[model samples]
Target: MQGKALPGFRDFYPEELALRNHIFAVWRSVARRYGFEEYDGPPLEPLEIYTQKSGEEIVEQLYAFEDKGGRKVALRPEMTPTLARMVGERAQALKKPIRWFAIPQLFRYERQQRGRLREHFQLNMDVIGEAGPAADAEVMAAALDIMRAFGLGPAEVRLRISDRRVVVAKLRHSHHVAADELVPVLAALDKWERAPADSERLLTDALRADRARVRPVLEFMSGLRDGAAELRESAAAEPLNECVQRLGAMGLGPFVEVDFTIVRGLAYYTGIVFELFDQGRSLRAICGGGRYDDLIKAIAGVDLPCVGFGMGDVVLGELLKDRAKQPEAPAQLDAFLVAVSGEDVEPVLKLAHELRDQGVAVEYGLRHAAIRKQLELAAARGAPRAVIVGPDERAASEVVVRDLNAGTEEKVPVARLLNGFFR
Candidate 1:
């Protein structure tokens, strides 16, 4: 009987692993370019770490249970909680505006979808202890640069920027929606903009305010969609505005879009929020994060203003495939060694190891085999060249190097063959 991976889990065969590695390479490269030092924490942590920020209800969504030691623990579903505690512990010694990034394989007990999965590697890039708007722009620029690294451009993806304070201010001044109803109202707006036909009734009911201060404000809020679509009046929008300008100066203006509706579903975001969405907006958010000023203090018990974003490999991979920007297929062996005679096996083995030691990916059969069969195996292994060692060539301290792709052959002396075959 064959066992299978659980639903929503992945089995990364060679080809799939190639794509995964490509994603990781780009993630690390771009993150390093932004001056973000890589950091990581244990995958399993005390359950209270998450509970401190999200409360007990979050346990239901986590793979949380009691350990054999009778300690409550859970697989980490996100990196922020751990980041908070780690940074909090070193808050004094660490310099301000700390830049760190982590690529963690996170887990959650949730239904799987096109972009959402139970297990996936996420690139979490955050700037901590930085309250200025430039930090916001820096993180956003990092996210966009990752997309650009993979050949995606302005036409393929869009950055929807919003400030939670601006949204609340506009809603309070116009819709008269109470603080108690803010979550639902903002959620409804988020849905209404995406799935208007479905959320029409909910949004209509949400906007139906009996207070006299509501109608005009509701009208104004609704008109925002058609207006300049900029919140120039709010004080909180100033930093957001500065962030946008910084991105513009960095030549990323085309990818930016201001939509006040992006009141990120999370309650922790205190200021600017942004989500990267595909131009079509068909899948889930490609990436999302915002300025969470007090989240560190709340969870880690140390105050640190942080801004960051998490981009999962699953959706980003899918997006890359859709755009035909995925990396080329994994490379094959650099060379295959074939010994023409039983006596030649000794030379073949010796040279194979030397090539391998020199960092060339060379493969050879373990048992005796005919030269034709060896060449066949070399082709099967996708080696573009075969180093053929025969008694005649070995006697002369030379080997026949066959260029399989070009169907050409050359005899190079054994002295130079070790380092010169690949050359």
Candidate 2:
């Protein structure tokens, strides 16, 4: 049998798992602070749930197969479809503006690259049942706060935000792109920055118009990336402007920018799309999402509006390491109990149990060992203190407490030691 993790998966050792836990802690803390409750669905869901929301072509990226029950299923690649289904099942019974978040391990059968794996854990935060810019601002705030919790600020990360309505309006009125051809044009625009010539060809083909018409559209799109397109006063840009204003009022203005180039490339995104990127742009997007007003209706026959984002751990962890924000693993033990002689072993065990019961992280050798050997083990485990129960100290109802780091020692009464002294 092969003795390694699958190409795009990971094996989180203690240190790696600690980092993962730290990321998750920050995610939960910020979500709760924003009054967003955590929720999760089955890791494996009906395949149609995804195809229904994103079309049949998405099957190319799914970990899908037929099960023994003769039903088609797939490991979830994203959380939005499941969120819509869960919300729709009891939409009327739930309160307005449902706030929910989830940390799910998502799978996708795709090529791996820097900051991208076939499988990864992602934090998904969504606001449902609200259709206004307030919901949009709320979701964006939560995402930004999580980045802040990780010792990141606007200078380290940037939020590029846009509104599909604004982009569509520009295409219709200025570029003369027809409604029937919007989808392909949007897809081509998504590729514009990465492959300008190819994207231009795609745009030319999708528009089926004169080559002359495509140049104006390309120039307009270029201006959006170069900080030359100024559409803030346009009516279609109102919702995005309001969202940016809300973020600004909350003092998150420095982290945000009105970049029309960020269309999110998702067909379901109807308005206010945003992506979080490292300021250096050294990796893939750390997060991306937007409002999908008709997605719930399309997937579950419910007309609730929703906004959310998915932040993956792969790119996020890479960014943290690059920015020197990775966290250290917590100490394994608070104290190590040592027995000086055979006679003191029982006292050492008793004191170890008492300290542990009092909420101290205590550890000791499972069997008898020399005092020096036990202290060495304690040091290896990064225990800060070692409690030595010697014959004389045990007789005097005391123990010698040694600070491993400072190399200091003191005699403490057993009674004082048991009463939450170590903690």
Candidate 3:
């Protein structure tokens, strides 16, 4: 038997890391385009942080343990807790509606699935002071544009959105559901899509009322599926309607929709919630977030309105791979320097150094090797061009540059080579 990475962990070799880096680059670029500055926090935080936000039972899914100092700590499973803490500490000093982003490697002790890993990097972008529907549109737009940057179109992914608070209000006002029963009923709605029977069961159990009383609630839930017009007219759904219009005005209307089923599973989401899923429904959510208006206040005693989303690299990378949107790993070097003979080594080293200092990626064999072997090595390393330094060229202060792929050679003076080839 051979040793391997832990069951849910991953080992990213060079080629694999290229894809990860590409995702990060696109994440940062898209985030910056939205004026969201990057930020970070420690990977480890007090275990109470997680417990406080999600309750003690959440420890079962967290990589939690006590340290030598007897302080319980855990790898952060999500960025919102840390963001809440950080924002709370400086809420008074910082500007309103803080626009910040972080690419954090989150860890969780959970069963492995296609897109769910033990550890993965996630892009967290949050607006921490705005409560308007426009802020929701902005965060949603950032998530959508990142997918767009990877060449994914609206056809590949769609943002299914819902507002738990608004829906709860509508249910309470129209269906006569009590405020005490909202959470369980909302949970039912969250699962209503895949398990309508289970949802009905849960809702009935929570309500303890007859099926006649629950009929309106179920109709309300059903209306969310394809009832954009009717629901949009309701005052309870005005914020969501405004958000839809905002996205439409921005031309991202085609990428998003209204679906009350997206309660986000987490209890913190208080306003418009959404999850981006593949059009084919073949994977877990590629991204998910929504308004957590009071979470900051509850966690850190700072009541900053916040809207954000977390897009994990694991599911996204899988989605990109499936769509063939991932870029191929970059080739090794811009040029490889090969010495024709022992006497030509010094000039080759000098030119290689100079070229490197000039910002060109250049590589050469460390020990003396045959010219043929050197060129072979260059090709093996995927160098596009090879600079052959022979006695004749060295004597003439020139070098022969061979295009590895084109199989053509050209001679240029060492002084002019930089300007000609690199330019």
Candidate 4:
């Protein structure tokens, strides 16, 4: 039997890897442009990191077990807990408002889906030691900038913004819901758009009330989905207002939409929360994140306000393909060296290494082969040009350069070819 990649996993062939690398390049470029330095941690960590942040329920979705040394560990499902632990270790000595980002391959044990997977790579951008709306706006702007870098625009993607504070305020004041019931209500609200019936049933169960009593709360939440402008009347919207205003000042207003329903479904999001979606709403969130002021303290006993977002490659790759944004695989070689006869093989080897030393991606036949066969290999490898070395040309201190795509050939001085003339 032929072995296969596990379900919900992928095999990144050269072409697919090219697209993944393209996404990663854009992510790193935009993150660095925003002054966020790249960082990484071990892919495997203590199992408690996931369990502590999300509780024991998360263990069911983690690839976890006891190690040979009797230590419980798991492949990290998310990067935030790792970030918190790292930052917390150096909190006092590190400079304020730390800006950091990581590209990690995360693993999860879950059902396979179009966007969701058991294993995937994610771009995690984070800001630590800052608590204000400016930090919120900063991360959001960085995310939008990445989309722009990928040829996505407001017309193609929408940044759905919200704040946990605002949602809690509306739930408590307007509907008089108790603080104790907020968790269950939020769990329902997180799934409200995808499964309204389930959401309502959960909400009703949480409130311990009949459908009639839950109707007003449902209506209130429905109105919030209208847009951000609807929430301005509440003082709880202050932080979100400033964040949106900051985005507006940066000319990113068109990509931003306020919605009170984006509570992020997590208990730790203490402040602003948000998710990015394709304007078509055909896939899961392209990215999602929020402020969690207490996570560092919980994980590492260091209190530092933080805001961040995780943009996974799986869904983003799907979106890019849908929108025709995937980049072509880069040409594998600048030139291929061809030996016309046994005597020319030595010079072909020498010239190949020389061109490579000059920073050109040059390849040549590793073993003796026919000149025609060599040219065929060059074309297959996507080499732009082929440098043909023959006894006559070698004697003249020159070689024939054949353009694979144009099917044109020209004689070039050996010195010129070695000096990056082709490059």
Clashes of each: 1, 0, 1, 0
The per-model lDDT (C-alpha) reads: 0.85, 0.89, 0.89, 0.90
Tens-digit lDDT string for candidate 2 (196-236): 88888889899785787888888887877664247777898
Evaluated at residue 251, the lDDT of candidate 1 is 100
Candidate 3: C-alpha RMSD to true structure equals: 1.7
Considering summed lDDT, which 10 consecutive residues are worst modelled in model 1? 209-218
- Model 3 clash pairs? 97-129
Query: For model 1, how many clashes?
Result: 1
Please give the distance, in angstroms, between residue 336's alpha carbon in candidate 2 and its true position after superposition: 0.4
TM value for model 4: 0.94
Candidate rank order under lDDT: 4, 2, 3, 1
Q: Per-residue lDDT tens digits of candidate 4, residues 366-398?
A: 887998899999999999999999999988999
* Clash-forming residue pairs, model 1: 174-217
Single out the weakest 10-residue window by summed lDDT for candidate 2.
224-233
Better of 1 and 4 by lDDT: 4
Cα lDDT of candidate 4 equals: 0.90
Query: Of 1 and 3, which scores higher on lDDT?
Result: 3
**How does model 1 score by TM-score?**
0.93
